[model samples]
Target chain A: MRRILPWLTPLVLGALFLASGQQEVIIKVMGGAQKPALAVPDFRGGGDAAQHTGVFNETLYTDLDESGLFTMVAKSMFPLAVPQRPEDFRAPLPPPPRRKDAQPQRQGPWLTDWSAPPANASHLAFGYLAVQNEQLVLFGWLFDVTQQDVSNAQLFGKRYFGPLSADGARKVAHEFASDIIVQFGGAPLTASKIYFISDRTGFKEVWSMNPDGSEQKQLTNYRSICTTPAVSADGTRLAFTTYARVNPMIFIHSLETGRRLPFYNQVASMNATPAFTPDGRQVLYASTASGYAQIYIANADGSGVRRLSNVRAIEVEPKVSPKGGEVVFVSGRSGPQQIYKMNLDGANVERLTTGEGEASNPAWHPSGEVIAFAWTRGFEPGNWNLFLMDVASRRVDQLTHGAGRNENPSWAPDGRHLAFSSNRSGSSQIWTMLADGTKLRRLTSQGRNEKPVWGK
Target chain B: MLTKKYVAALLLSFAILFAAGCKKKAPAPPPPPPPPPAEAPAPKPNPPMITLFAAEPGTIERGQSSTLKWAVEGADDITIEPGIGRVSANGSRQVFPSSTTTYTLIARGPGGEARRTATVNVTAPPPPPPPPAPKATFEERLAREVQDAFFDYDKSNIRDDARATLTRNADALKAIFRDFPDRSVSVEGHCDERGSAEYNLGLGDRRATSAKEFLVQLGVPADKLRTISYGKERPQCTESNESCWQRNRRAHFAPGQ
Candidate 1:
């Protein structure tokens, strides 16, 4: 069952829209995880760009489907007549034709065709595109077919402009989807990027891509082994480990300046697994300066370093909690590598995993209420699957089953999706899945890819 | 000839018979001289051969032992001085000596005596192994060992059994350093395929450093050692089992460039 809160006073919505200027009105589905089934018909356009039109339609559908916030109705089930504007919406759908074998016909009201039988869709997203002076102009609208009045059923009206090309159509589609998703109480995924280590260039360097695996670009060209990419929350500075100087050390690359910023060199020990604090002012990593790998935190520029762990065990993969007051890291102090949590000051150390199995690569959810990590679970050699643990209840859930090695899980900014690396498809590739282990999508197929960290 | 001449005449026969009697008397005189000089000789007994007399192991370290073996024939008594006494004609004895010493065995028989000596050279104990070289830096510790350090699955810290192996490796490195004082060893860290390629590189580095630190604590010079991590790229075994993974997760040693 789904509940729509469109009854929120216009005064409040006006205040919100006035403050953010991002959306006209919010349409939230309250109660359980039930998502409103939405039908997105093809966009009618007056351009010689059938391919661009197809690209826009497919991109829009995929963006909404992958958002995990809606149940997309297939185009095959859509009504023969599609609404390209609010005026095209018709109320009081006509009755089905009286025949032994009847089919959905264009004679019925578009809303009735969508809100009733086969489509059974509660929402409809329709749009129109036109090429004006080599520019693609898109007019998009979302409607609640449950409403009879056209004005009451219409959700919002938006326009997007891009080059009259497939890529431009895809960009416009992304923007339109972002606008619709914002109304459904979900952050726009278009702004989020995933940073990962890719060896496609003959060396493992930091590479990044859009959340939907588009617009992939190499961020680091260090012709040496680089790994454990941690992008700052603001998406400006990227911290990672590289052996560019023959020693594994922390390197802070400026995504803004496109240059490697200065980082303090500890000289003589490997520094790895650098994570930026939520505020992006400091970094947390594991270093071997104390004769053993220990968790350490330093300023963003690698100054004013302070040790956070002193145990004589292997401690690495330090990830600062999203809340900024704690850290989750992998440590061998308990004989087997286990996820451990501690205060930012290195106090109150607590092991999070219990019983048998070795766990590593702890990634905190955006809400800081749970963590995702890779664990062996006593399955024996080469089977490290991903798992999630609720920070409050200590209840653990296996996010990934045995399908080769799955590790390096990074949570999306929305806290409902994850990006990780797995060899399930052969040759360790970057993959993304919903937080519930659904909708697993492979993001990279060129060479070996691993340690995908999703950045806001 | 006198007898023949005497026979020529019967009347001269009495003279010939008197000449033959004179010749027979001369012979009788010689027999009488032999009879006066008859005497007996005394008998002699065999001497001791002293066939075998020596220590089974001629040299030994302090607190160690050797065996003394001896064999003699035709001897009534056989005695070994400097710790051993009367012994059987053929027997052996274990000897424990604090210092180098020689044992002498004398065999006495009716005819004569024979003597043989055996020495058990006890070596002095080695000076207590010097404590870890205090001057060696931490980085050098990672590069000096001649043995690979093994780790548990996904772990980089040294294991208990690996400690013993590293101890022996440290001693081997010390011996090697003595012969090639200018040579260096590279501590190459590796990992099994069980870990992410990125994390495993860090883990491999930790394993190598752990072994290096242990070797340094065992007195191997840190300056003669350098460390490198191959992560899971250089797997010693490719099989997907604990044995294979254990083979892969090791801090192997190699001659430094």
Candidate 2:
């Protein structure tokens, strides 16, 4: 196994760099007995990588909660020990190593205890990376907290020929993680694409392609803010929020028609974040009609007007199950954004995400078992991360290496993969990855794409 | 080396099965619902009126509402009602006055308004349903529900509802005979919107069969009335309502057409 690390290290690094920086998560577990499982990605890293002697610790937690595989716990419910901000978190310039390393760099503040995590999380997979001698090195370990032992660990370090940027260096780390995921017999990831919005086209509009940065195309040409793009269960009809001369309203475009229809008029209010229900019979959308963002349901024809949530809260990104029986949305009822769910008739409201940094833009699986959402690190701007939660087991899995701003996750019709937008590769672009955060790929190569919605 | 490995891995990931998941959104199981209780006397007949909503034209003076009018002519007590502000009918013109109005008009009265103001634009009113045609009463609903012959799913066996339609047909049959004496009456049966159109047509025929058998049982002679099925093509309600479907799920009665 140790001998194979050197040979596999270069392949892992190459895979990471080629992933196109659309999504920096989707790491798999290489060489494992559990059928090659992948970890949940949470892409939320920030700051210069040179600070911690090039060491970046990224954790990819495999969630068996959804899919009836195992129980899951929401990471928001996990007792996380917050880190105190250093007066200067930036890494100080290092002295010449030739000069006896001059003054040794001060040790960074230690990460607090993760000893006893939230309920229902029995296993945790963690990864760490560092750049030594300008060569990237990675090590990963999955911990079974119940047993208080390392369930899995491996070291992978390699050098990349040609000039590679820090983005390429981080991607090398992600591939190593995905390797472990496949060893556990989980579904192989790698076929997905994220659609998001960016101002690269000189205006905020929607663009998309593949998660590995290919086949990029602009879906909307509106000069105004065309933010929300909701994909249908079959991945054909895209319901998105468009702002015309009137207030921001929702609309749908048929991939076959290339024709845009007025989905529903929000009547002078900002109607945005069109999420399709599982049955494709209705769209759960958000509007500013209630003085703030609130969830509302409109028939596929946009006729029926029923409010799904009514409270002093900002509820946006209403995603419904394929059966159209239940809906999960982001609620700001608890001061910060959190994930919550209620039935189609607005009964049995349950809070699933709490205490996480501004949970938003949740996308549900077609099977109605899992939900992927964008999370922010507390008090940090531009630290959007991705997280997953299983419905049955209530287990939370973090899928990213905390790389850069990643948000707006959209799942494909089959629910085995997700697409999201990220700025980790410098400019914002759409990315795709397997549902478990493996086989990371970039679907958009040019322009800025955000808020991807898979087709019907 | 790094680029090659990422390239190779991306290709290998494709070599495996493309990511796919369970295609599950099962249709909801048919729930055991409470059978409607006697259909509740078919409710009072709703007065038909040319109710219209106004669409705004262009920008008018801010804080100034436009006037919209309507005219109804169905019932006697002509009480003109406006959704926002009250309007009166003077010389057949109902004027709606409001400040800062969107020019929206909602009218309710015995006689519906011919002209409706949608915003600041003048709209040529929707043509009213040409003078009131005779409304089918509860007796018509009851008569429509009665079938000449009702049959099992795939069988043309006569059922209970067919007996009821035939019993009612006995009186109507006597009246027809008194008018023409020698003329024969043909019974047409209609099936509800439950089965396929073609299948319902056959079911309708079965209903007609049951009704004809009852007529035969009534000693009305066999060669007089023939039976036919229209199937579920005609619906009582287009909206998604079980009550409407159930109402539609019956054998309709027709003398000829």
Which candidate number maximizes lDDT?
1
What DockQ would candidate 1 receive versus the native complex? 0.19
Q: What is candidate 2's CAPRI-style docking category based on DockQ?
A: incorrect
lDDT of residue B188 for candidate 2:
52
Which residue segments of model 2 deviate by more than 4 Å?
Answer: A1-194, A210-212, A377-382, B1-257
Interface DockQ per candidate = 0.19, 0.00
Candidate 1 residues lying further than 4 Å off, grouped into runs, are A1-31, A91-108, B1-183, B195-206, B213-219, B237-239, B255-257
In order of appearance, the predictions have TM-scores of 0.70, 0.39
lDDT of 2 by residue, A63-90 (tens): 2322212334455654433222222122
> Pick by TM-score: which candidate is best?
1
Per-residue lDDT for B220 in model 1? Answer: 93
Lowest summed lDDT over 10 consecutive residues: which window, candidate 2 chain B? B193-202
